[model samples]
Target: MRFTWAQRLTIAAAIAVAPMSAAHAWNESGHRIVARIAWDELTRPQQVFASELLVRHPRFAEDFAARMPPDIAARAADDPERQRWVFMHAAIWPDLLKAEGKRLSERIAALPAGAEKTELERRLADVKRYDNATWHYDNKPILIDPYALPPAAPPGAKPIGVQQALPNALRELDDRNLPAERRAVALAWVLHLLGDSHQPLHAVSLFSARHLPQGDLGGNVFFVVKPRPADPTPVRLHAVWDDMLGTDPKLEAATKRQIVAAFPRSRLKQELAEPADPPAVEAMVNLWLDESYRAADTSVYDANLRAALLAPLPAGATSALPVALDRRYLPAALPVARRRAALAGYRLADCIRRAESRSRP
Candidate 1:
């Protein structure tokens, strides 16, 4: 039986709400690039519709408008430009929630049992419940050894992985019966997770007999040194991929424009040529995950770099030693990362279009 996008999305969402922890995929700049690309592709009417929905977000006033940079906030603009600004920033809302949730956790822990503490506790619960940081990646461990298979989840364990989360967000986005505020939050997650799913590191975890028996937590546990001389210190493998596009938060606007200009138009044209039907969309997501898994195994975890950087594992060691990426690794991986980002944008736009079409009267 063929499953409609709505049905698959429903199942995915139901599975994801069970609580599983994972890392965020692309950094803010990378997510912004995907958002900007998708935004540029959307029709004016579609953009307006999306912006209207976003404004319905419960915290839009405080989190978006009031928190806008002084210059933009002073203008008090509510035109399409202002709407687009809000829409683009929505892509990063999950990340923002993570920061807010952390501080809230600290505050809640410090507060005594009083009215103020009770109120803070309630808000903290909401933030934790809605925080999508863990929803960004699937921790399905990819065993490096070709002969070995990945470990199965324990019979009773329910880990809501990224593969499950994307469809859940999509289902939420398409549920017109739901409040616009709820749908808007889902839309933000859809945008963010689409970008996350395309990042190779986010889709797969490395497993080896000597090191990662369970998994590397999608490279979170696998530290790697930056190739740059100035920043030789070890960083998470996942973080390096997250910042592949660029790291400066202030540079998002310019970087968005630069990426748009530099994006291979032919490739983008090829990807957008045909949108996947509802039944096929989940398969498309799975396909993207598989492709990313292959990349992580072949390129990101190439043997040469592993040999150069990783120290010899001690007998009975449970983890691989942190390793430095070769100078050539970054240069080699950058193009692949850029291509994936561009493809994510095109695919996201397609998903948005499909959802809009299905929701139409």
Candidate 2:
């Protein structure tokens, strides 16, 4: 059965509000798509090496294998295929860790200060150590006004943006000197963050003098509602884009196959032609971020969409209120969202191949 845009949006928004929390970039389906694409492109040895590392993930058995879907569990051909599935789920591990951390903190708060509380606090610290949540998105502020320059960081302040984080993860994946366990963790993050960086919202934040002088926190605070008669509860603009790919794993897998097939063959061939050296890889990542920033500037922060979604502040009106998305907004943005997901998958494959090449003797 076919679903209209409105129906899809309703289902997506409902899912967003339910038990599943929104992720930093493309949601679970999007990340899984990227991982699946990369996995498909990997050579046999590369695949085996990646799986071996992933099998060593500290929580692979408890947090990954145990949570595998019944369908996937039943159909695995062998250990290698199951390992690949585990690696794909690992793409969402950081977000899951966030949720787990929150739950642990709540439990700790409910208990009195005792040995249990102390142990819980220690566990929380352990979770936080691996959290590195900010690594998912660069959040480099972009001024909406063409004439304005990006804000400079204050003296002595250090920011480990996604651009840095992703390359760092790649380095960790390539560094044989690091313990295999440590490298495995880095491999999982590399799988995830490469996908995150391709998401326009994760790469850039929109800044404007009239409404969002400090930036929209990567669209997280920009409230948007579906038209009246539909659910009017305001949702974050980022959340809307994040949910565009839907949440079903089977559907996502099918969509990944379709998107991969539909992607321009010439462009895909050019991207995968030769593994890039480190400097070239950095340049490629910067180029990708620039592309996303331009999309944020033009499409995501389009003046027409903004005007439709937000009412003018009355004379001396201080607070910006949520407004309905323009009828045309989603129709136009959906293709861009799909294109980004496809590009992310392609680039992730390129990166994994590069990492594998560098790791080989």
Clashes of 1: 0
Choose the strongest candidate by TM-score.
Answer: 1
The lDDT values for all models are 0.73, 0.73
Alpha-carbon error at 194 in model 2, in Å?
Answer: 0.3
Worst-scoring 10-residue span by lDDT in model 2: 14-23
Which regions of candidate 1 deviate over 4 angstroms?
1-22, 146-152, 275-278, 306-320, 358-361
Which candidate number would show the highest lDDT if scored against the true structure? 1
What's model 1's TM-score? 0.84
- Runs in model 2 deviating more than 4 A are 1-23, 70-80, 145-156, 227-230, 264-280, 306-320
Candidate 2 per-residue C-alpha lDDT over 201-316 given as tens digits, one digit per residue, 9 for 90 to 100: 88776666655555566777666776556566667788887887777877977887776776744555654354444355467678778778777877877676555325556565
**lDDT score, candidate 2, position 327:** 73
